[model samples]
Target chain A: MKELEDRIRRDGTIKPGNVLKVDAFLNHQCDVALFDAMGAHWAQLFAGRQIDKILTIEASGIGIACVAARHFGNVPVVFAKKTQSINLDGDQYVSSIYSFTKQREYPVIVAKRFLQAGEHVLLIDDFLAKGNALHGLIDICKHAGVIVEGIGIAIEKGFQEGGSKLRKEGYDVKSLAIVEKMDADTGNIEFATTD
Target chain B: MKELEDRIRRDGTIKPGNVLKVDAFLNHQCDVALFDAMGAHWAQLFAGRQIDKILTIEASGIGIACVAARHFGNVPVVFAKKTQSINLDGDQYVSSIYSFTKQREYPVIVAKRFLQAGEHVLLIDDFLAKGNALHGLIDICKHAGVIVEGIGIAIEKGFQEGGSKLRKEGYDVKSLAIVEKMDADTGNIEFATTD
Candidate 1:
């Protein structure tokens, strides 16, 4: 976790409007080794919990979740699709979320057969800001009747309400790096102290 | 390679209109263990190549490429984005491609900073059907002036012209499972024999 926090400090850029650009290493261009380490940290944090599958949203979370799946004993990683495709047929658990990054609302879809009742699933994502995406994934999990074992986040905006809201809702949220404050003009960033 | 072929034969579904769905393990719901095996196989096939990075598209290819990057010494995996986002700022290498599955023309975008001139890249994808997606990635690679060391494909529809055409273009293509023929009615799929 310290490694991740350090990496973010060194490589991450703080933009105006609280936009933290980590595309250099986290999302667009992935550091799989870092992802593996994050996975290991989550495995330690969520030890003793049953994680049958890893549920994440598409485009960004797929890489991190898949790499982290190795730490979770290679559990199946089901990425919820943002767009509907012809390939996505049959019964599906659908939930809609609004993405500020993309500036649009899109449906998160997972095939029904992929999620079975009573399965314990670990939710993983790159960032937790407004928690709209997490809420959508949680909604799908609810519809599928799957148990939410835990939530693993690579980076969480501590100033935002997403992480706190989820924690208050009885969800075990483990974020490796939480940005407490960031400055756009001075390019300075601060992280929340976690034990 | 045999492990991948076997898994495909077992879990892959043949739908009408020549659709071979391996979503059960490959794309939608990913089997990371199987993906690790496929990564190892590609490592063997593309051995001795100077692979500086693994380039792929978003959604499906990100997981496979990121997991496979470990076999390539944990190289950075850069996935091209299909849609424009506020997070995706600055200069980028953009190319348009038509997706048969999504039934729309989308842009494949890679940030210019992620790719450097003369860097050797290995293109990885989940499927190589008509090669539209690969072509888009290759175009972006050309714009970025990166050397494509090889192309690693999880599955290739040999009946389609994509794989053959890419091979004709003098690319070192290694497809784990090449479906030479498939029957939708009978749900039988056959792979092309390889060494």
Candidate 2:
């Protein structure tokens, strides 16, 4: 977690709309070594827990979820696809979610056979802003009869209410690096206390 | 590679239109243990080579690339984004690619800083059919002045022209499992000889 925070501070560039660009290491260009370490951290945090699978949304979350699964006893990882491809079978468990970043609503889906009833799912993602994507995944889990064990996020915009709202509802949400505050003018990133 | 061949034969489904769906493990619902084995396999095939980074495309390729990177000495893995997002900044090397799967001409972008000149890059992907995505990533490397050491594919539709073309051109292409033919009636899959 400290390595992630340090990497974010060293390479994360602040843009106009509260955007912390970690494309250098977190998103576009990934540090697999760091990913393994983070996976170890998650394994430690979720030790002695019954996690049957790791579920995440497509694109950015896939890489993190894959590496993290190595630590979580090599559990299977199911990523909800953002778009329904022509090759994708017609039958699926679907949920609609709004992307606050893109300012649009998209349907997220997974093959019905993947997520089974009573399966304990650990939801993972790269960033949590308004919590729309996380909730969408949770909705799909609900439809599939899967239990949402907990949520694991790499970076959370703590100023936003997404993290707090989920915690208030008694959901176990774990975040590695949280940006408490950011200033574009000064290029400052304030991290939240781990506890 | 035999293990991968067995997985495809056992779990892979052949659809009507020459679609080989291995979403159960390779892409959608990822098996981390198998991914580790795959990473090790790739490492053995590309042994004694200096690989600085692993490049791949979004969605399916991320998981494979992340796991494969562990075997490549935990090299940094970079995935080109298929969609535009607010998080991706202005400074980027972009390439336009046409996806037959979705029937669209969209742009894939990588942070300009991710791929550096003179770095040895190994392109890894889930499927190599028409080789459009692989070519696009290779073009990005050309634009960025990076050296493409080789290309690693999990599965290659040998009936397609993608593999043959790359092989003709003398590119170091290694497909873990190459499917020569598939019969939906008999539920049979034939893997081509890599030797």
**TM-score (chain A only) for the predictions, listed in order:** 0.99, 0.97
> Which residue segments of model 2 deviate by more than 4 Å?
none
Interface RMSD of each: 0.5, 1.1
Query: What would the TM-scores of all predictions be?
Result: 0.99, 0.97
Which candidate number has the best lDDT? 1
lDDT of 1: 0.93
lDDT of each model, Cα atoms only? 0.93, 0.89
Docking class of 2: high
Candidate 1: give the clashing pairs: none
lDDT of 1 at B52: 96
DockQ, every prediction: 0.95, 0.83
The sequence of per-residue lDDT tens digits that candidate 2 reaches over residues B128-182 is 9999898889889999999988899999999999988987877899999999999
lDDT of 2 by residue, A1-195 (tens): 798899899988888788778887878888888888888888887778799999998888999999999888889999999887766785799999999776789999999999989999899999998899998998898899999888999999999989999899788888999999999889989999873
Kindly give the stretch of ten consecutive residues in candidate 1 chain A with the minimal lDDT sum. Answer: A186-195
For the record, the alpha-carbon RMSD of candidate 1 to the native fold, in angstroms, is: 0.7
